[model samples]
Target chain A: MQYPEPIARLIDSYMKLPGIGEKSATRLAFYTLGMSDADVDNFAKSLRAVKRDLHYCSVCGNITEDDPCPICKDKTRDQSRVLVVERSRDIMAMERMKEYHGLYHVLHGTISPSEGTGPQDINLESLLKRLEAHKEIQEVIVATNASLDGETTAQYLAHLIKPAGIKVTRLAHGLSAGADIDYTDEVTLFRAVQGRTEM
Target chain B: MQYPEPIARLIDSYMKLPGIGEKSATRLAFYTLGMSDADVDNFAKSLRAVKRDLHYCSVCGNITEDDPCPICKDKTRDQSRVLVVERSRDIMAMERMKEYHGLYHVLHGTISPSEGTGPQDINLESLLKRLEAHKEIQEVIVATNASLDGETTAQYLAHLIKPAGIKVTRLAHGLSAGADIDYTDEVTLFRAVQGRTEM
Candidate 1:
């Protein structure tokens, strides 16, 4: 028998999410049945609010309720050093680290030649404009992922921003904080040895 | 950095679901952001509707939008047989087979002494009342999961119903269909041997 119309609709909705299938959707729908009315209402409200209230920051392309986003608006942050990333969530990650008090620029996506995603396609033009407008900025830290597309985007950014006399830097790649040397890959090990300090 | 207010709230809501943690919730929240406006609206509506529109079937304790549920309301299904299961989702699992054309009685939960879930704590009274009220039901097929509590509940039901001259039966325990014989557990193999049918 069909799961009553309401539940069936909910299951279908849940299945649209990544990694969720028909079985998991059905399970989640039933679990929702057991939740308190207030909780269910709050959940629905949050789901709608995420889509309704949030928008990309006009300045840095980061997600925020404000047009410029909180990070973009804050005058206390180090405006001279702007960290560049592929997504707004990357900004959240950096903030969680709490080490970098600099401004941010979100690229939204990387330059993947295989996928036909070029500098023109991603959030590139705005970066150049932002740099041009803000003469105080001295450094552009390319904190894109260590993937091939990430490297390509970083190189492209360096090539363009270097001519403008602004220092362009990429995040160092090597062993992650908690990684074990025995299990480390050859390339990462090589990079770690090459970049090792005297200490 | 906080995931802006709306996305952060959405992530928390998603974490309330079974098997979803902080990382998965974050992924789902961002994915939701990427979903179309129409799809997001439908998802929110369905989430709210599931809580607002659905209720437990008054007759069988199965969840449904209707009071008696479609299974209990149907006249074409075999009135002589009633399949007993632990929860509403179990009924859906049974129906997916498309093999059973009988009415259903949901127990909501099995009798588990260890967990302090007694027969009285379950939907047993209504089931007994239904059996007495409807003399047409000639047989009961106990289809609870193959677990200790399920076995106890099945035995309890048989004891209570058999005295009324109705034929009470439990679903057979054997190697499941498409099961590899070599990898099958000893208990299941024993049941398979004991309950072997004549060709």
Candidate 2:
């Protein structure tokens, strides 16, 4: 069905997101249409402010309103370890666990040969520069998801860090805490068998 | 997990919607944060404009930028039979069906005593005034949802309109097309039996 010009334009903009489709875009557009002028303005203002007021942390590449970001600048956080992740969302997840006191390095994306994504495509150079500048960093942990590209990126990072005399470890993979063996994916089952630990 | 002030404010705003939870709000907020400056600005502007520019149609209470709304002003549409619905969304749904060519009246809410909603709370008065003024109006279809409040409102309006000499009817209540007889609810089955037709 055809929508008015402004409504169509708004729907098209919403459909550009990674997961959103035409139906959802139309729903969102109609929802927007129902909103009061002030509320709609506020929503639009917030969207604009997000892009205007935020930037990537210079040191870690984590999203931040400030240059260094709160985590990177904190004097109490452990400086001898760094957790490398695929995106800022992963950084948010790690922060939620409250178990990580080290700093973070956001790669922005993984190196996927099929996707034409390589080491040079991501912010890997900054990580190397951080390694060279920070003498206190004794360990780097690769916390990317246990996917094919994630594994490859971890391996590549491990190799790059080894010559600098820093220990690099990938996050452990095994049977999930409550998962049934039969229902587990084949790759996860294989990893569980390969990384079998003592009882 | 705690976020910076601006981020927290934005997330809270997103969380105010019906289906959105704290985590989803965070995700949406971050997604907004990653958007381009122009995209963000446009989204914010649309939100503001939606609320500011659009006003309820004085005649039918449907949302509109103009006074009477496009449907009410259209000379070609049949105004003799008016379809009454609970909200703007319902109007959109009926429009999508493309079978109904009559005009519409948006109540903006259903008459729910439990929620402190009554006839006065919606656009019922305006609807009555429209019917009173228009002598050509022959039938009014109460197309509200098949819920307790919808039925109550329809019955109340039917009683109110009986003395005015205008025909009032509720939408047909029966097993929907393609629905199995066994799957239909008790109330629907009862209504279907009570309103049964000749072969």
Candidate 3:
């Protein structure tokens, strides 16, 4: 026998999430049924609240309930150096390292000419406007991944910032991760060898 | 900074589902935020509807929207034999095989002494009463899995039903398809040898 129509519908709702398939969705729906009545009600209420309350930060484009966001408004952080990244999740990763004390600028996405994504498509205009308005800024670190798209975007940003007499630096490359020499990609292998240091 | 209070609450709600940890819950919350408003509303509506509409079938204890359920009401199926199963999913599996034409009785669960589940814990009394009230019933097939708990429940049923002057049988077993003798577990290998037949 199949689930009741509503149960099936709830299962379908769960299946919309990333990595959750039909079987997992059904399991999740049954699990929900076992939850307390208040918990289920709270779950449904939370779904609605996230969509209603959360918004993008106006200055950095990070997810926030406030327009300027906590990082952008913080007076203690270094305003001279801004780390440019692609998404809010990247901000989380950076925060976990506890290495960077500068403010951030989220480009939201990279330029992919084939996919109709250009500099105009993302929040680059805001970065330019921020740089123009904030004269104290000295360095802009392009902290994007070393993928082709990230490199292209970083190069494009460097070209734009270099004309403004601001220093632009790319993240350094080193031995990557759990990778065997035989299995490593050619580009990564070449980079590793080129950037190798003598002890 | 972390998500806003409302968004964090929403993420926490998604975390309550089975197999969903904190990070996955946050990902799902973001995915939901990306969904269209209509889809989000439909998802919430379906959850409420499932709770409101679902009922247990009076005859077999399987979940159903109606009292006796479609399977129990179908006159074309063999009413004299009942395939007693552990859950509704088992009924779906049997139906997919297209070999079983008899009716079904869902016990909802098996007797597990460790879990404080005994014969009275499941719908065993209802099943016995159904068997006693129906004179046309000639055989009962115990189609529970071959797990230790399933075996224990099957043995318990065999003792209960043999004195009622009714025939009872279990699904035959030897070796599973696509299993190698070298890789098969010792118990399964022993059963395979014990049940071997001459060609």
Task: Report, in order, each candidate's fnat.
Answer: 0.87, 0.40, 0.58
> Highest lDDT among the candidates is held by which one?
1
RMSD of 2: 3.1
Each model's DockQ score: 0.85, 0.35, 0.54
lDDT of 3 by residue, A1-199 (tens): 4566767788899888789899888878766665777887787777777677778888988878778888999999999998999877688779878889898999888987667789998889999998999988999999887877788899999999999998898787756677788888888878888888889
Q: Per-model TM-score of chain A alone? A: 0.94, 0.95, 0.87
Model 3 residue B22 CA deviation (Å) reads 2.7
What does candidate 2's lDDT look like per residue over A8-127, in tens digits? 667777676446788777777777776555555556656666676778899999878888999999989999999999988798789889999999999999999989999999889999
Q: Which predicted model would earn the best TM-score?
A: 1
lDDT of 1 by residue, A155-176 (tens): 9999999999999988887899
Docking class of 1: high
Q: How high is the DockQ of candidate 2?
A: 0.35
Task: Give the better candidate number (2 or 3) by TM-score.
Answer: 2
What lDDT does candidate 3 reach at residue A12? 90
Q: Positional deviation of A107 in candidate 2, in angstroms?
A: 0.7
Residue-wise C-alpha lDDT for candidate 1, range B67-139, written one tens digit per residue: 8888889999999999999999999889999999999999989999999999889999998999999999999
Q: Residues B1-199, candidate 3, lDDT per residue (tens digit)?
A: 5667876898888877777888888778777876888888787777666666767789987677788888889899998999888877678779878888898888878999878899988889988999999978899999888888888888899899879988888877778989988889999888889888999
State in Å the error of residue A88, model 1: 1.4
Cα-based TM-score, every candidate = 0.96, 0.87, 0.85
Stretches of candidate 1 exceeding 4 Å from the true structure: none
